[model samples]
Target: MRNEIMRCFAVVFTVIMIVSGCSGREETKTAGGGGEEDTKPTYEFRLAETHAPDYPTTLADKHFAELVHERSDGRIKIDVFPSAALGEEAAAIEQVQLGAIDFVRTSAGPLAEFNKDYAVFSLPYLFDSDEHVWNFLLSEHGDQLLDSLESSKMLGLAYYSSGARSFYSSKPLAGLEDLQGQKIRIQQNAVNIDLMDALGASATPMAFGEVYSGLQTGVIDAAENNYPSYYSTGHYEVAPYFLLDGHQRIPEVLVISMTAWEKLSEEDQELIRTAAKDSIAFQREKWAEYEQLAEEEIRDAGVTVTEVADVSAWQKAVQPVLEKHGADYQDLLDAVEALRP
Candidate 1:
């Protein structure tokens, strides 16, 4: 009876050990239950965007994330936080500078606050047309400007079109002459402030998210942005007068933190750069579509749309602004001028 009892105990102990070993193996298996080894991504990153999720920039951000994931063969993942979920552009950029945020799609306007070289894009009437802007942005000088961001601990991965900025006001603004003494909301940039001053308007530096309330509460008499922004933000509801002056054609820059970038292998870096460039086509196409739709929708909504048929007069008004700030960006200005017809 004692031998039989010992034999039973031995069998139970062996079975228990075998079961534990199998469970250990199961726990070590891939998340997909494909194999015995784990297959999680090597790196996971976050990208910040100040635009709404349905906005063109946000869509392009997702596209960029998808391409990176694909090109990296799932070894990498990029999660995009849009609509200022992370923070506003300025705060987000600071976070990125500190290496706390992996990436951000910020306006060149706010970006200039970090790297003054970016301020060139905010100069009013710098580009004759959208084509002129793109030509310069795609040229050798544009690449140099992008590379110069390294001084600020960031990298300019690519440029996405923000369209051209124009003024919209709570009160009627028939022409440049009407802008005198009007309190206008502008981006927080010295160049933009100077541009507003040169145009004879009181420059109220305000955040993008605050413009709607600013307009409604009369904190600002006018604000300037593109057609898509005016319509999408519903700024047209309160600011019924939309003047298509196209003052600034600042590009939205896709920037990555050098901290996060350094951790990536050269191959992955190249992959991300390519992915960002590839995403621009989609973003620009959507921008064009959205722009036209925005104009039409705002017009249908009874917003007065004024076209600057001859921007020469408006251009002449901003000459001092260019002359004052132009010295800092002479090389870039020369390059930009060379691109014009």
Candidate 2:
């Protein structure tokens, strides 16, 4: 599994570098009458996504691209590559830094590998609720966190609502004790692995593409994700019990390559930024609609919608994981604690 995942990542880097790094895409204007060079400029940008076209993240990217093109009067074209056409987000992130790709939409899990400060947001129950998460993202502190990526050669443009993630398994989760001994598939990362360990479940990390099959074959007893993803990926076909524990409110982000940003004219830069921030409202509304639709439809399919009776117990159990991980990044933890709903 590890070798296959690495191979997937390797192919992305090799192919994308040749296309983006070794060449530049341009849009040029023709001289009106005289044999003079065209002064007007043109640009073509690439936006990478790991979700299907109908997915919320991909829909938002398309909407954002449309707005950019319309707002820029067609001088800027943002070609949206859905379903990881360019590469997985993790691989595209490095390419984004080198200007091999212009934009990416991904979860916070892979992003933390690029910046430790992002680790705070990935921690379980870090926010009181969705509104609390939004408040922090829109606050002055949130802007600072967005700006934090400047050091990493990327710019955090806006946050898209991914909703809260919960566990869905072949069997129902009655409470915290139910998690003991279950083999759960989590994002391949230290924080997530440690999170499962703390809960007494064995963490199995694998590619997202292989998850549906894994669950069907009993390779993993349970897998966790947002409701839209759970439905969209068809994981519910195997894991019929979904516990609305709402453990992690992992928000997705739209990022631009800093190297590419630097090359754009100041006026164009402002337009891109404005369009990106503007897409938040559109994406959030679509997300809310999808969340409602998924819940209603999934339950109607005879799947059990289990409610987490005692969240306090789950939070208490996961506290040690947060404490240990937060020790290295104390300021951010303090910042999260300082955030009041």
Best by lDDT: 1
lDDT per residue, candidate 2, 129-187, as tens digits? 88888877887777787788989999998889999999989867666777889999887
How does each model score on lDDT?
0.88, 0.85
Candidate 2: how large is its RMSD?
A: 6.7
Compose the digit string of candidate 1's lDDT tens values, residues 1-341.
99999999999999998555321212122445554565332677889998889899999999999999898777677889988998989999998998888899988899889888899999888888889999999899888888888999999999999889999999998899889999999889899888888889999988888999999999999999999989888999999998888888999999999998888768779999999999999999988988899888999999988898998988888889888889999988889989986
TM-scores for the candidates: 0.87, 0.87
Model 2 lDDT on a 0 to 1 scale? 0.85
* Span of 10 residues, lowest total lDDT, candidate 1: 21-30
Q: RMSDs, each prediction? A: 10.4, 6.7
Residue pairs that clash (backbone atoms under 3 angstroms), model 2: none
**lDDT at 140 for candidate 1?**
93
